[model samples]
Target: MAKYELNTKEQHFATTRLEAEAIVTEAKEDKHLIMHKIAEKHNKYGEYFLVDLTFSYNTPKEIMGVE
Candidate 1:
């Protein structure tokens, strides 16, 4: 195996994985409900890092309860 030295962005992205492309397609049809269910599942199963980062970046005000 080759050695690797990942930078910060690579490290963060490396920790995120989407298990199934189908789930993404499903979310495309019903974004609100499917994404909520996915978030809950990731939280419960301890794979919430990516979703957390995405929401934190994309919805900082909403997540942080700011105005």
Candidate 2:
């Protein structure tokens, strides 16, 4: 996969992503126990776009404030 580098300004609007997974014996279950690993990346102040990577199971839990 190709990744775009993060610039300084756009870093402020960055989102969080991490490697995580849920396991369940049944596949049809609507929900599985969700767990996330502890890892964080800071967005720089000069970047023009958002974060540099896309990930799985990544969602906005809450929007705290604007950049």
What's the CA RMSD for each of the models? 16.0, 17.7
Per-residue lDDT of 39 in model 2:
36
- Writing each residue's lDDT as its tens digit, candidate 2 over 1-67 gives 5333322211112232211112121211424223212234344643222322222332333222221
lDDT of 2: 0.26
Backbone atom clashes (below 3 Å) for every candidate: 0, 11
Instruction: State how far residue 8 of model 1 sits from its true place (Å).
Output: 27
Give the CA lDDT, 0 to 100, for residue 27 in model 1: 40
How does candidate 1 score on lDDT? 0.33
* Candidate 1 deviant stretches above 4 angstroms: 1-19, 31-67
Error of 1 at 33 (Å): 7.8
Error of 1 at 48 (Å): 14
Instruction: Judging by lDDT against the true structure, name the best candidate.
Output: 1
